[model samples]
Target: MSPSPSSRFRQQLIVAPAVLGLALVAACSNSSSSTGGGGGGSATLAGDCAEYQPYAGHSGTTVTMFASILSPESDSLQQSWAKFSSCTGIKISYEGSNDFESQLPVRVNGGQAPDLAIIPQPGLLAQMVKTGQVKKPDATTVANENKWSPVWKTYGSVDGVFYAAPMSANMKSLVWYSPSAFKKAGYQVPTTWADLMKLSDTIAKSGTNGSKPWCGGIGSGTATGWPATDWLEEVVLGGQGGDVYDQWVSHKIKFSDPQITGAMQTVANWMQNPAWVNGGFGDVKSIATTTFQDAGGPILTGKCWMLQQASFYEAQWPKGTKVGPDGDVYAFHLPAVNPAIPNPVEGGGEFVTAFSDRPEVRAVQDYLSTAAWADSRIKVPNATGWVSANQGVDKSLYTDPIDQLSAAELTDPTATFRFDASDMMPAAVGSGQEWKSLTAWFAEGQSIQQTARDIDSAWPQ
Candidate 1:
């Protein structure tokens, strides 16, 4: 569906020179707790209300939200708040994405939490619900206005109550490459797992003529092993199919299950081979800034043929480079890893959460539910490559062709889209043991069996 007039106009405003100053203000203020739900009134349970016409003229309320590091997505959030304020006359406070995760708990425990929050990790939201620090949506009221997908809704549920609303989602099982290079090398896109491995082998063999086949970087500080974990999960999903991966993430299956072992063994075999990755794969930290930078380096310099990453990687490309003929950039769905399983995509979504029990907090939630607000707030011109999770928004909002393609892939019904398995696991397994163990395996030559055991040990009891 096409974006509304207000959304289109807001997109123009965000790109105007005058609006640049407001961009900083919008991102910083809208993301914090200084904006909505400030006063004292019992939070109302708005049951199954299809459209919330917030009590008119509620100017004193504040809605604070937190998100990850700023990028194109930040522009969308800001525009959303701007539209929300215009519609309901409410103010919003915003903050950096990383700040909220650490700061929210301390403040909530101290009784100074914001009314609303957008957490990137579901495990954190789960903790909030468990501690009674957050409130469940009035199901009758929420169900009336918004219908959520089973995948999105389930992530925010704890004991049958929904605590958060999912915003935007991206497809992760994609490998981006330069079409020009592919054409020059006479390579054909492979559709199945066996064919994909053969393609990689062909690219590797071509490297003898001085072209590297793949661009693999495992560095992101503190999150160093994430890239590798993506490879592992992709392979596992392909090798054992989604059902087994789902069981593993939900803790129904052990990390050391035979299927998982085989997946890890596949990764070990690939990394151990000198041709598959660069020399620094074993030494870099996953979260290190350089890791992201390196992933794009090979492509920019025409050294490597492909880089497998999520849609967000487009924002990280070097300044002034465009995709296609004008720019050497393009992406394809990560080829099926196993011929036996259906080709499903893996990725994650961002959600908005609340810590306040005030009436105005619901107003902010209602505002976010509107397509007008989402269209205006999320279509940042500078962030040309981000795909939105909101259904029926204008595809024209995305300027980059690759972003457009990714968005189309996400909406395909035949494709199975699941959250990144590692990220979906409980924090101990998702962030602590699993991340550290994988990095250790790469850098220190830690045994694969021990790494699997370490991950298994960290699973929540």
Candidate 2:
């Protein structure tokens, strides 16, 4: 699947202030009244970064940022930054690298840090805080964070201090399917895990031209096994409950712990069985070679019944693919595992941090955390994929129905939200061994116990 809409990146551009002002007026006219940080008020419009506009005289100033955003996401961000620059006169020099997690420390340790950085993994953010290279967020930024659920503050906090502000959020509890095919087969959407399995079994027994019940892939270049890790994390959220999942992510419990191993087993039961997955790719091992971006392709061709992925997967569909409840392709929440457990959401987003305490940089940081920035970001033509967890962002601002639905899911008070657990682990384990072991489990035929043991061994002291 495409990376979460909240992935961070940097770019530098300037827009005509007058044009931006007009855009802001138009957006404001179309905006909803859900003041994000401020109390109940109209949503912010582009160039409506009311609190930070005082820094407009800082036009010559530039804030450098480092992040993992690139390509299409970079294009969207640049479009958003142009307006911010025009409104505040502070330029942004953004740089996105795939190796951001590995390279950020080198830059900081070498005393070559940027003015700010958009960090995607809190574990890496914590590591930077330990080195004293990161600074605490300003009060205004803190207030913006507080406007959202306490979860945003918790994600950006370390040692009881909030240092980063939430930038973007993606929903991860979706199961993508072909609505037309389901209708043709007279199947209803499943509401619980048991129902989902029963539906899978029914699909398999129906002999729909010998197609598998599911399609999956874990390949992502060096990030190959990350998707499988997501599956296990989601299972843990429902199968074992959030508190235990939290302990596992903090490494308070070993990877070989029954709670974790059982989750992994749950994933294997679907992924390892030929009747359940790799519908178009032939066998389970093919999942290792099939790119995640193309993994859900079989759903359109009716070769696979479902593909569990995040809301961001909407962008990967071929052009003209319908994505609403009645569209050619659509998504539903992966059903709850237990009635007693509140619905759990597994997702990720970027966090904003600063290396410089200069007024201009601080102003830019404050603006980004507010509803104004979200409005400006969404107004950009290339940002159709964007979604904000900020309570202030209006549903009307989202052009895509899927984005709106995802945003609703993120802001749902009844749902439990947790960041991707692998991202919260030490880099050596989260991005390294977890990726390797999960890949080996499915592709190399490693036993579940051995896979769990291998990951546990890779954990740091």
Candidate 3:
């Protein structure tokens, strides 16, 4: 089966030219007496429904949701709701669309908005809050997010108020490879960025069937160059450290700043090398035309040894392809540049925000915030790419090794994690010039310095 629209659109998030800023409001705080876990709702609540028994009286109410989590993920989430529905009788009607970002405002403006929405971009969430399209999350929900890493709380907050809770997350700092091929070639996983480059040199020189060491593709139709953005983000997180990364995302640092241009040049150092990228596709420019969905294929065919991508890239592999340390395919964390910087995690996730504060909606939100819900989400099952950052979630529940590692990376307290920066910038820049400039830089032979300057110039005044 072809990838779901949700999977495809996951590469791109919508942006708008809103004048509002997140500084305008503060994040919401916990108000409920319940702890991070939803307090038991009913005195008679027992067994699987005990935690949610208190919500039994709210059964007649309905909770409607809008989001971009389509297909297998949506199916598993729906099945995971069995216990919550059984206990609360709150009927859930979720509508997943490829156009959620665009359609959301229309629904709100039309006064036909759902009770909740799974917002993918914090920037967009801030815009919605500014326009009064989103409601503050209740204390119970806030408490749950509070228990997670501060990054989750920060992403869900607009200004000082928290209005959303993290639902699902993925790790982007990964380099996929074939375990069998690596074993045959006597290659070991690199633990540091320097070691990774050294390994790349070895592979390129070994010339396994005259193949290259890396494969990459940035093509994504109108969203082309997003994967390229991921490369820049990963390198920036490593090269400049997280504090600078934060400033860069908020536009406190100009795109033309040395940090950015330096990072872009670092990307050019490898990607622009004819011996490093494009693998079976021929020249470096072919990376501009190769669909990201097809970029990993060369790794499987032994034409390339590695492809840098996010954990979700597991879905792009042919069905039933084995994935593990000993399986046909496996992925290792992209090693850190400076070990003292703490391993930087480049990833993204969905934030659950409410449009309505109805009791039923609150109950649904409360249940979702609980550990029971997080755990159940993985157990409900499908082809496993699902993982949770919830400290309460058990990594063993993830059947796929990729999902397990992704979760571990997210839950790693010492890890320096940052959301995708482009998704957090002003629409005119993030989805506009940043995408255009980077594409031209790689595909059209534009200078990295010129591309950085061009993108900096496009930042909204």
Leading candidate by TM-score: 2
For candidate 3, write residues 368-442 as lDDT tens digits.
Answer: 877778888788645466677888777667777899899888888788888888767765576558778888987
Please write out the lDDT profile of model 2 over residues 13-125, one tens digit for every residue: 22212123335333223133342221213333333544443444454566788776665566577677665665454667777765566678889999999888888777777
TM-score of model number 1: 0.81
Residue pairs of candidate 2 with colliding backbone atoms: 10-94, 59-89
The CA lDDT at 294 in model 2 is: 86
Q: What lDDT, from 0 to 1, does candidate 3 have?
A: 0.75
Reference-based TM-score, model 3:
0.83
lDDT of each: 0.60, 0.75, 0.75
Q: Which model, 2 or 3, shows the larger TM-score?
A: 2
Order of candidates by TM-score, top first? 2, 3, 1
